[model samples]
Target: MDHNINTKTEEETITSTSIHQESKLLGSNKSSYKQILAIGGGKGGVGKTLVTANFAITLARAGAKVTLVDLDLGGANLHTCLGVEMSSRTLSDVFSSDIENIEDLCAPTIVPNLQLISGAHDSLNAANLPHAQKQKLIQRLQQLKSDYVILDLGAGTSFNTLDFFIAADVGILVVLPEPTSIENAYRFIKSAFYRKLKNIEHQLDARELVDKIVEKKEELGIKTPADLLSAIENESSDLGGKVRLAMNEMNLKLVVNQTRTGTDAEIGFGVKNVCKKYFGINVDYLGNLEYDSAVWQSVRRRKPLAVEFPTNPLVATMQKMVGHIVAEQAEKIKNEKSYE
Candidate 1:
């Protein structure tokens, strides 16, 4: 990958020479194109967007063509993080007017091999984009050509967000160690599971079982998946089987961010335990990121944490998590290809 080029400027030399050397040294390998990863959080202010942007840049720096899409329609700060000013054309223009191709709105970022598609800037339109338009946007994303497409999703359990999260090849939920964030994260996982079950309700007694679970939420105190499964099994075996299949096929991962101590690191373990004991969901605790001042400083400078502090502890943690996710996904793709 390292091809010496004639460059004079210091920036050009660093970008061309150093990055190529690093990519080669890291043994970065390419895979068949078309991978989508969505970074989401149930609660805001957990560094979801920041991590998304940096991780995209990191992948790009490793010689993969990456597209970092800002899907946080109401609050689009991804462009700012990438040091790109508001472009004339955005997803808003595509949705509201005569735009033939969604790729027309893609704007190049400062980082080579990385591009961004800004979301609608108009608060009213962004917040109220019809379901059809949202579906169209996702379809466009699916057609994008790149090794990886990382989506920075908005905080909430709205249908739009949940749909995007489920659509991703890998759905990473970023959470802090606080009690409220943990509670919200659990709720988000449960909601996503229920949503997935609803989508496949045509299979046997899935619909009825799900309805019973929802109707008796107060009666069953269904705070965990185990409780929900027990209730489902008691109510209907067919529905329970469907739910079990969905849970087994789930591709969800968790990342505990802003870790301050050993206790904070234990959050991921606790979540995994709760998920296994209660929901029958075996969530992979991908990794934990340490609290770093450099993260906040990079935000102030409108730069990604990975870019600003490439060797920082948090960046190392994120890179390790990304590696695990990528390897697992690559294995799945290879198996699929073999079956084909």
Candidate 2:
């Protein structure tokens, strides 16, 4: 569960075994791994599902095999957004041992090249599982054979939500222009930062320092992760360097949703700069999605917005965000190859 790409020693074995088995399943070499795109927000009704459904459709249309997962363990409605009925075997099947593997629960959506993995019902206690079950699920997710796996995470910074978000190759934090949403978004990032620091390279001393900083936020007037980092560096520069490297390795992206005015559109950039200055973390502002009535109309009809209104402005924004992600992933793969 190390936050940076190096992962934990145990995780290295998991990856090697996963690639070996899954690559044989797909009859392909382990030359590339599937891209995982996850969308999470601090609160509900912030368009996390909407963005996820359309984003998956866009990538699938580009001929990439994609799977949209409803990781909203408490409340799973991604099926509703995709206009697909519930599968006979949902995540509950896996939780109940009715299904041996999560991939067995895969069901097709209306869109070609895309599949859906329905969420587990809260009644099944899928949201808060024993540690063994959670680890098994995480490993299974790594072996999913798809070009992309889009996870629509539930709201808030719950441990389950935060772990899935952290596991994603491209984790997106969505927020609205409203004050409540913005505040929650900031909280979400802060919680994620602490969680990440707590796990990175198993540095307990640095993690303890982070805990103290967070606990003293009110008294010390620390508003950003960067401010907290400065305090740690003042205590010990060596620990601060490790923290900096860990934070820099994380690629937490942001998107402002349901924006109406020009001011609303610019809010993402503002938040990005603030995070950079105070958090000492670089946030990629993938741009904002403007408010469009057609979005609701499509959701009402239970069709993806991209399918219903391909020419909508919001769709264009989704396209641009996808393009950025593809480019970023390509660059990342290229660098990995160069190092190899």
Best by TM-score: 2
Compared to the true structure, candidate 2 yields what TM-score? 0.84
RMSD of each: 6.0, 8.9
Tens digits of per-residue lDDT, candidate 2, 307-334, equal 7776677876786677677667766765
Regions of candidate 2 where Cα sits further than 4 Å from its true position: 1-32, 122-124, 201-223, 231-239
- Model 1, residue 16: distance off in Å is 17
**Model 1 per-residue lDDT tens digits across residues 1-340:** 1121221223233333433433343343433346789888799999898779867866676556788888888987899878889888877876778877767888888888899998777665676667788788888887776778898988888887887887787888999999999998888887887777676676554776677677989888887667777778778776677777666565778888889999999989999888889778778898788888898898999888766666566766766666666667656655665686
Residue-level error in angstroms, candidate 1, position 119: 1.8
Clashes of each: 4, 0
TM-scores of all predicted structures: 0.83, 0.84
Model 2, global lDDT: 0.77
